[model samples]
Target: MIIIDAGHGGVDPGANGHGVTEKDWTLEVSLHQYHFLRKLGIQCKVTRDRDVLLTPERRAALVKQSGAKVCISNHYNAGGGSGAEVIQSIYSKSKLAKQAADALMAAGMPVRRVFSRKGTAGDYYYMHRLTGSVETIIVEYGFLDSAIDMKKLSIRSFRLQLAEEAALAAVKYSRGVENSLYVVQSGAYYAKDKAEKLCEELKQKGYEAFVRRMN
Candidate 1:
């Protein structure tokens, strides 16, 4: 499972350009990603489902409580940049976040490096600071202040594509594909003993089996 945070909201409109508010776009993209992940059977939770402002500490708490392995915060850049940038926590390996950046690039969004904060060897965002226990990444979708970037961000279809690509990244990250093989799902049971019994049966049948706890 993953926790996604839509950066800025309500009074904190974030960066603005071309008559579009950053908060609105972040929510749209985050919500779309959440929907796509759910459709793919990937469990996910969002910090805010609507136009509400949440403090960084509050957001961090939510992510921790969700028991998500990863957290992604969505935002837009400003000042003068014309592409996408993925920022990861300093303590994180950044494997999943880089995969996400690659997926975005493949989906037609420009790539502007996946990196950590300047000077410090850790994440600069408050959410990352408080939620360092979990791998956290902040995505600057594109530069809202740049005219070139604005052209792409203004397209609704492109936003949908971004959402789809982001969700695909989450799915890939969760699965951790290392080999091509067959998978047999025995069953999904709420009780631990039932799952253990099923695994034992599969083992007796000469099949390698294990139980994965899901949220």
Candidate 2:
């Protein structure tokens, strides 16, 4: 199962967004991601089903209870900042976190770098203390107040793009088996070129490789 948490809700309008509230946007994106994942046969559970106040602890408990392999906490950070930032569990070196973070980066999510805060930063976020080794990521997806970002969020097409990136990261990170798998991405550009180059390099290393283009 994959646990999706839409941060802050109800009367608590986390980071007011011009006329839009962070709570509302968070729920919207979270639901979008959850439904998309479910449609693809991935199990999903949310921390808050509707608008309501929930402490970080309660949210974390929900993640733990869901028996999720990964917890994706969706949120819109405040303070008039912009760009995407994902907080991964302290296992920064873990291949799972590396794959997820790299996927997001390669997909061009506006992020500086993925960081580990568990047991180091304040534990109130709940994502900090995990009952298991579940790979978790709390993504603060741009600022609601930023004019540039708000303009993008105003479009459903744009939000769906974000969800796509999240989905891409989830699949890549969760499935590490080396096999014949093709990731559908925007035309044969960076990823395509990279894959082609890797295939050639693998051949040099005495392994057959091929590049499959997506339609």
Candidate 3:
């Protein structure tokens, strides 16, 4: 299982830009990721499903309690800087964090860097500090303050792409693949109607079966 933190909620709106609030976007993306992963048979838990503020300590406690092996704290940057960044704990090096960041870059958000917390030994970020054994990383999707970034974020399709990429990365971190295919062929029909019939029947039986159109 994995823990996903939709950082900054309630009174904490996080970074704001182009009339969009970080809290709202974070929750939107996080929940999208949650459902996507769940559909792929990967268990996931979100810190806050709704617009409610959660202290870093409390969020960390939730991750610990969830017995999750990996965690991601989602946020948006506020500074004038543009592009995305993935930050790992000062205490550990995480290839999983890098993978997620790269996935985000592929989806659209240009990666500024994959880095760890600087200054002081041990955990620099509170959420990173308290996650215990869970390999946690902070994903700043893009600089909300940057006009270029905000313009991209304003697109609904872009946001959906970001959510989908995050879900793909999480699955990679846990299961080392986006999906484990389990194909169950119920029937084959040259007629499109018969194939659609079997597809609906499989869907009713709780199996995600589909028909393939071949040339």
Candidate 4:
């Protein structure tokens, strides 16, 4: 089973920018992903389904108790960065993190990076360090402080798409299907010229890239 965590709620509103709170956004995406997984017959659980508070310790305890293999902690970025990011434990491999990043990229979100951070003890985040053996992934969907990100995050459909794509990635990884084939697209563009421009850039970097029209 997978555990979905909506980061920061109740008293902790998390980052606030452009009139949106990080807690609400995280919860929205988590709820969407929870239902999507359920509909697909995938066993999953959410940390919080409403605007209630969950201490970091409490959240970690729930994840450990659930005996879940994977825990996806969803949070929105802030402090002025563009694109999405996936953070994994320093002890784990980047396979799952890469999958999550790729899913966000496919959903028209630029991926900043997929990497691990270390604390003095173990993993930098409590979700990773305190969650026992569960592979916890912290997904920063987009930066609320970034105009580029806000343009997309402001759209409800776009936010839902991010949640759905992330859920699909979690399902694939948690099921032990790590070798699934994936299309590596840099980003989606409205203008054909812009798409071609990015395609050329990738090709220059020794990547065999092409621009494909999405119907």
- Which candidate number has the best lDDT? 4
- What TM-score, computed on C-alpha atoms, does each candidate reach? 0.79, 0.72, 0.83, 0.82
Report lDDT (Cα) of residue 51, candidate 3.
Answer: 95
Of 1 and 4, the candidate ahead on TM-score is: 4
lDDT for each residue of candidate 4 in 1-215, tens digit (9 for 90 to 100): 99999999999999988999999999999998887677555789999999999998999999999878998999998897899999999988788899999989988999998989888998889999999988889999999989999998999888988887888888788877776645566799999999999988987998767665554
CA displacement after TM-score superposition, residue 99 of candidate 1 (Å): 0.6
Task: Estimate the TM-score for candidate 2.
Answer: 0.72
Residue 47 local lDDT, model 4 = 95
In the range 14-101, model 3's lDDT, one tens digit per residue, is: 9887778999999998887787667556788999999998877788899878888888888889868998888998776677777888
TM-score of 3: 0.83
Candidate ranking under TM-score, highest first, comes to 3, 4, 1, 2
On a 0 to 1 TM-score scale, where does candidate 4 land against the true structure? 0.82
Q: Is candidate 1 or candidate 2 better by TM-score?
A: 1
Per-residue lDDT, model 2, residue 147, is 85
Question: How much lDDT does each candidate structure score?
Answer: 0.81, 0.67, 0.81, 0.89
Over 4 Å off in model 4, which ranges?
178-215
Residue 198 alpha-carbon offset, candidate 2, angstroms? 36
Q: List runs of model 1 lying over 4 Å from the truth.
A: 118-122, 178-215
Where's the lowest-lDDT run of ten residues in candidate 1? 175-184
